[model samples]
Target: MNSYFVTATGTDIGKTFCTAGLLRANPTLSAIKPLLSGYEEEQAESSDSGQLLAAMGREATGANISAITPWRYKAPLSPDMAAAREGQSIDYAALLGFCRAELAKGPTLIEGAGGAAVPLTPTKLTVDWIADLGLPVLLVTGSYLGGISHCITTAEFLLRRHISIHAVLLNESPQAPVPEAQTQATLERYLPCRIFPVRRDAGAEDFRTLAL
Candidate 1:
């Protein structure tokens, strides 16, 4: 089955937004955000899990979000810290097991909690978990100030670890410091991977080639 772990250079860099676009582009693939921090029950319809469910042609209801995401923390912090604030801790093994089970079922898009290096457990980095999963990555970055450096640095780190990068998606950010074309060109020069820009309202056809 074709699967990928979607991550980003940092928080609010449009990982969910990009993932939703990819889902809209490819409806057959199932999407899940197994671990989520800063989640409030009242905002279920606007949360990352909710957005993912929407992209999959499902309604963004409490049950739907919870079904896809088992671990939800209220604190808007890293998973480890967020879980701690509520007197809870993430079972890294269980989390891995859940993802493995999902992958075994079929093609799945597993979205990470934060940036590539964010700590899921106090001892495990997000990238480390990605490596453990052994799936290619769909990295989402933005065209904002310092974005060029952030994207290149992230790609370099992943490559050094021998992680296969399916693609680098350059999503537009508000008040971008540099044009999207320049950033994409610069990244293409340094990384041996496919680079594409995604619009805020991108359709399935827009991501048709990369969804494969």
Candidate 2:
């Protein structure tokens, strides 16, 4: 099974959006946001798990969402802090095991909770979890002001840790402060990997050729 971890420069910068696009382009690939914070049961239809379920051609039911994202917290904080608020803690070993098991099923795309540096557990960053899993990453960032620096810094950090980067996807944002071409060119100059620009209104065909 082909699997890749999808992370972003920052939260709400289109990680889920880009993942959904990829799922639409390649329906055979299964996607999951293993751990999600700020998850409201009443708003399941619009949550990250809900969106991913819809992209995979499944109904965003409560049971389905729970199956995909087992560790969910109501607080809209980082996973660690969110879990702490509920007097709980993430079992890193178990979480890693779950991810490994899921990847064994088939082509899977595991979406991280936030930026690559976000804390998964007290001692583990999101990138650290990806490194432990030994899966290549698809770094998703926005085409906004300072985006180039954010993308490069995150990529460099991963490269320093010997994490294989599958690609850098620059998802165009509405009212983007910087032009998409400029952001793409800057990233291309510094990174050794391919960089893809996903338009603000990208369609399935737009992502059809992506080698995720």
Report, for all candidates in order, the number of backbone clashes. Answer: 1, 0
lDDT of 1 by residue, 124-189 (tens): 988989999999999999989899899999988888888999999999888887778888998899
Model 2 CA deviation exceeding 4 Å by range: none
Residue 102 accuracy (lDDT) in model 2: 93
C-alpha displacement of 201 in model 1, angstroms? Answer: 3.1
| Cα error, candidate 2, residue 140 (Å) | 0.5
Q: lDDT winner among the candidates?
A: 2
Cα error, candidate 2, residue 17 (Å): 0.6
Sliding window of 10 residues with minimal summed lDDT for model 1? 203-212
Report the error of model 1 at residue 67, Å.
1.6
